[model samples]
Target chain A: MRDAYHEELDSIGEGLVEMARLVGSAIGRATTAILDSDLKLAETVIEGDKKVDDLQHDLEARAIALLARQQPVATDLRIVVTSLRMSADLERSGDLAQHVAKLARLRFPERAVPQDLHATILEMGQLAQRLMAKAAEVIVTKDIDLAMQLEQDDDEMDLLHRTLFQHLIDDRWKHGIETAVDVTLLGRYYERYADHAVAVAKRVVYLVTGEHADDLQQDIPPVTRVEGA
Target chain B: MRDAYHEELDSIGEGLVEMARLVGSAIGRATTAILDSDLKLAETVIEGDKKVDDLQHDLEARAIALLARQQPVATDLRIVVTSLRMSADLERSGDLAQHVAKLARLRFPERAVPQDLHATILEMGQLAQRLMAKAAEVIVTKDIDLAMQLEQDDDEMDLLHRTLFQHLIDDRWKHGIETAVDVTLLGRYYERYADHAVAVAKRVVYLVTGEHADDLQQDIPPVTRVEGA
Candidate 1:
């Protein structure tokens, strides 16, 4: 019975890693779709999200069933509970990716991102993918240091997010209100995708260290309040 | 022992209701602060969020302790687990309200919503407050029908959100990009606040009927995809 319980735990970890991989690919493709205005690729990412959703649902059921049957205590209990949260974070990350894809689809033949801003959006997307990959690594290896580093990595994404906003608010911005809204929402999607990755890493940090990440200084600021201007 | 367990469960329920009430008020005041450009009220909302955070931490600890100690199974187990999720939703709702307040603070003497849009934003704020109040009512009464109603309430918020964007995209939009960004973020904060309220109510519906809210038709559209235009 104990062996079987450990097996279930291992499977849950694998599920998280799989989810991370899927969502990582999703954001990457969604980015290319947006940058290149590839409607077909955007549609693929949107449809692919269902797979991520199904994985989360299956993982959640197994975790809950384990809780009911094994009645795990101590670290084992924390593992199950935290996995549930990590699954949620990954699921949300997938949804964010899907939102990016939908934005690409909405713009259709017209590019949502202007030519000058393409590089920044591409970099943001790459950073988001890397963060989720690192988050998955933290989960599988339970590497506390790697988990801690994910927060710092998120700072890069935040900088990119701010850069996007700065461009929009600049007097030189020629994009009409419609495109401005598109860019704003797109920046938010990538920023939030990184945030969910950081959240997953923080949960891993807690699982390994038994210390809540909130007790530690947060690397990323909670709210991006515009300074008095 | 059973009575003691029941008492603990009741306390958790009450904690959720209290959280709902606190966040409900926070959104209301945050709305007023933005509309009236009241820095003091915005500061109060920002500071008061700490209370909501502390309450959530306390509630989470209590819930986890109960789970470990009582080893609750079946419906009792569902109650504890679902309460944790609902607490999280409510806590996030508080953060959304704080974001609104922070935006207000950032704007300082200037109103975030233009005079023309003020009525719409005010209605959105009031709708948010009513939805949360209804969510709190559902928590206390476990009235599945009332729980279901909160989703429809959220639809009203989505409509308001859409209207705001329409105004921004219209050829008549004379507001600068900065104001447009402010309005966009503000509309999102209120929309998300209503979403969390609906999420809380859905959790109640699940607790009562053992039916997942996703199985029901979603009241608000998942992604705000613009149709071909």
Candidate 2:
């Protein structure tokens, strides 16, 4: 019975990994669809959302069942809880990607984004997607360095987001009220996407370190120690 | 050993309830301070934040210890996890209250708010504070109806938020940018407070029903059903 329990637990981990892969694919396709203005790809990403939702529900049920039947100890409990949280963040990330794709399809050159802004947005999307993928990598491999690097990657996304904001606010583009709303909502979606990735990274760090590292204060460079000091 | 574990768990619950009470008081004091421009009450709310923080950290430690040592089963595990999530929401609520106080103190009134908007804001504050207080009440009393009421109460805050936004955009006051920023931030804080309360209510519903309530769908008015149907 114990052997069977362990087998069940291992399969749960496998399910989480598979779900992460699909989520990552959804994000990748969504971003590509936005950049390429592919309506077909946008529709595909939207359709894919139901699968992610189903997987998330399945994962939650399995985790609860493991808790009920296997009576997992401290580490196993933590693992299940972390998996559940990860699934939530991954699902949100997928939603964000779909949101971005929907915006792309809705606008389709009608929104009149500045040409130069597209490169920055594409950069932001790639970085956010990579950070999410890295989170999954850390979860599977327990890679501390990879997880640590996510914070820096997120900082880059933040910088890009600010730049994108500046682009929208500039006088060169006389974006009307509706277009401005579109841009504002799109920018918020990207920023929130990056935030969910950061959340995933923080969870990964906690799962690996077994200690909360959520106090990663932004922008205030931590007082560095000198050798003499 | 088992008896000691039970004692500690019970104490953790007590601490969480106390934390919730502090958060509730902070929201009340902050809202009053903002509405009345009472600098003293603002200071009190700010000073009260440390207690919330301390309780939060203590509860986190206790929950972690309980999980590690007690190895609790289904219901007990749910209790510990619930405590952890509750403390997080409570801590955030306290932080929002402090933010409102800070904004109030920053823009100490040279004059009182115009009567109409003042009444609206006061209404919003009361509703938000009441919802937060009821979150604690429902948790302690296990009153599912009270929790359900909070879900309804969130819509009031939402309506007020919309009204405030519309009034601001109308620009009747000719308020300067700083004052506008203050009011906008204040509105956001109240909206977030209601959001946290709704979150807590959802948790209660989950605790009682063993199912997640779709809060968005819950907004739909129920129609009469024929017994034959």
Scored by TM-score, the top model is 1
In candidate 1, list every pair of residues with a backbone clash.
none
| Number of the predicted model whose DockQ against the real structure is largest | 1
Predicted candidate 1 versus true structure: per-residue lDDT over B1-229, tens digit per residue: 9999999999999999999999999999999999999999999998999899899989988988888899998999999989998998898889888888888888788887899999989999999999999999999999988887887778778888888888989999998897887887777778778888988888888888888777321222223533532
Q: Go through the candidates in order and give each one's DockQ.
A: 0.48, 0.16
Task: Please write out the lDDT profile of model 1 over residues A69-152, one tens digit for every residue.
Answer: 899988999999989989988988898898888888888888999998999999999999999999998988889888878878
In model 2, how large is the Cα lDDT of residue A12?
68
Residue pairs that clash (backbone atoms under 3 angstroms), model 2: none
Candidate 2 structure quality by residue, lDDT tens digits, B1-87: 988988998797788678778877888888888888888888899889888888888887787678767768777777776677677
